[model samples]
Target: MRDTAKAFGEGPAASIYAGFADLVSIGTCIAEWHAAVVAATSDADRFLRAAKEKASIWLKEYAGREHLLALGEIAANVSSVSTSDDGKAVLSKLAKQPLPLGIFASHPKERPIFDGDHRSVGKEKPKLAVAFVEFTIDGRPVADIQHMAPNVTHDLELHIRISRWPEKAERLVLTPLSVESATLYQLPTFKVSAPSGDPPFTFSVRERAVFSVPQSFFSRPLEFKYGAEFQPLSVEQPVEVVGQRTLRLESVDWQRNPQTGYANIDQRILRIRDELRRWPTVSQDERAICLKLLVNLAKHVGQAVQDNVFPGVWSEGQFQIEVRKALRNDPSIGSALQEHPRSAGGIGDLMFQGVPIELKVETNRTLALEDCKKFIKQTTSYAVGNGKRIGILCVLDTSPKVNPPFPMEEGIGILFREADGYVLPVVTILIQGNLTPPSHFSR
Candidate 1:
């Protein structure tokens, strides 16, 4: 059962991921990182080891330096119990169990050190190259690094398959333990006899990058409305058999942005904003979200909300949150958008659909055309400075006097677009009526 209210952003961690914008840069990195790791490797042995080591270091910031010691502890934990007469039991338990996934602040689960569950087929008899690590996000593989070489062939191939979720915050998170390889017994604990290679590395959550599921992904008590699909993040990704083949990574040469502050702003935030500038290039899912947002705000002179979401209090911040939440769903809305002016809120409310959207809460009921025209003086600069063609001005009218022709639903009229470019279309959505059953804005 899912808590229907979860559709509304509510909870302790709700603000952590204000919307999809919070995950843009990280998600892109994870997707591209897996591809690079596989393309850089020559054999399954290298791929498996590299996946753990690279993803760990890549996510060093989030997982922290403490994870390094955690890996060693995990090696000891698994090896102590690994010397069984039949390794199948060890493999069986490893197969059944996976790394930690769900996170419940109220009732947290026990987290272990390393989460590398593996199998051992004699090296002499190599299995067809399988996934050294079938790269996954939330139990679904989003990309392919190198594959297990058939007969230790060392062949490689890469494939990326990204999934789309209905919610904005459902963006992907790359785990440290996501790997599939041709070589069985890839876990650090399985290496009984030392091999001649780079230093023998052990796999552990501590040694690697392990992202706790975002609070948004936390499953609700009923698993709806108030929560996300909370699944357990396992130590090892589920392994599967596949044909060995050579593959190439996406041609994208991904790298962290250089530290060039755009007037004292963080480089990470700038790069994400750069990506957002390219939002028109993304898919059309935003139209659905925009429509939903508009209908909700207009329902009963209030809001119709997303799919099943009901009308709640409509404030300027609430409008900003909903717009951020809605626009974040567009694949192109790839910026960890934040409030303007670091601490002090500025004229601009926030970024949505990759553009800065200003929320104008009409304190008075009567909103005439002249009032909207005056607002352009305040918002046109954001569009001009950001080089955006669309200027979003969301006006929430708690009173219903000068409504109608003033723009209800989405009013796209001529605004200003600084220099040469498309007409700066200011999308004005009017949400009228106070507590009364005022009709939707018309003509």
Candidate 2:
């Protein structure tokens, strides 16, 4: 294991050091290797003598191999400092707009968002693609990037969010709530300057990887580009990713979970639950229909997963992706809701009027008792203390075997909170996907 660890780490460790040579050797960037050589450039004889001393000891201790290898690294390091720099012919100084250290000297000619929206297998999280273009419309710190859309071609801005927050963090992150598909874009860019006396600082990563026919694309970092803040350049089209899920759909069986008789005072809740199950809800049934739609919408997701009818593949996108699609695209659930605006916290998955719906996809065999307790706490906090009598919580426990008739188990979740020594009610119908094979699947 020790040898294996070193073997794996050395290649990347070496590449990182090697890639360092190009960026800083010309002093465009300040790196450790560049600093060492820069501090001694005025005294070449002294540097050569020092190198000779180390070379003698290295050669004696490990034959010529280690000595030659170290020399190669050092030589690469020195070659960079002695070669062409990125900005040798500096632009003549001029009256500059006071700006921050993060901006560049000129618009970095536009490029694609790259592999901005890909999620690889065995990763902790997907790289949520974010594109930043500086703009200050009406000179008010806020910029309505939305008004300027019709963005780059084939560029899918599934989530569109423009931010106007103060610069407070290492960086700012903005999220667009609506997920829509469009190909072209006319994004904006604003002009800003770097602070006085500092070399233009642009930390850019330009990478290209080839994914052969059967090999999946690797996870790529969030697209970070810099240009005139108000002059949002035309970004390169997003790289369309294709993938395949490894989970086999042996079969699925959808059976509605049985519910016991409800207490007399809670008949309304029971009726709402029953109405949602059998769709084509009556015109007079005025009870909050969002929850009903969510429950019914979730059915398409179960069937989709059971039959392998999804478009994108995720070694990770299996359950969550499919379920979110159902909640958003299903006509019964999405169209029936009054306001589909999304909210964080307990507003649930797809909210109707303001009720939150939480989607829990458990790898566990079923939506266990513990899952019920966990969902109750989450939905309660999301309800913000009001007796939000209509929130929904859905659970999917994916299975290995395929049931020809995919199953959907529905139940009631009682979210009780003690307020001044009295219990509060946050109730809803719970959908559980008891997916995994009943008999453990072994290779």
User: lDDT per residue, candidate 1, 346-421, as tens digits?
Assistant: 3567654445566676755556434576677456567556545455566655553433332232332234434454
**Least accurate 10 contiguous residues by lDDT in model 1:** 217-226
Model 2 compared with the native: what TM-score? 0.27
Question: What TM-score does each of the candidates earn?
Answer: 0.26, 0.27
Error of 2 at 260 (Å): 19
Find the candidate with the highest TM-score and give its number: 2
Q: Which stretches of candidate 1 lie over 4 Å from their true place?
A: 1-314, 329-337, 341-347, 352-354, 368-370, 400-412, 417-424, 433-435, 438-443
Find the 10 residues in a row with the least total lDDT in model 2: 245-254
| Alpha carbon lDDT of each predicted model | 0.34, 0.34
**Model 2: per-residue lDDT, tens digit, 1-443?**
22222233334333323322322232222232233343322223333344334434433443444423533343334322332231221101101112112222242223243355864334222322333323222232222111111111212121122222112222322222211111221222222322233332222221111111121111111111221122122332222222210111001011222112222212333344434323221121223444344345444444544544432222323555555565557555665443223344323444554555555655534443335666666665554433353345555544333443233223443445555654434444333344444344452
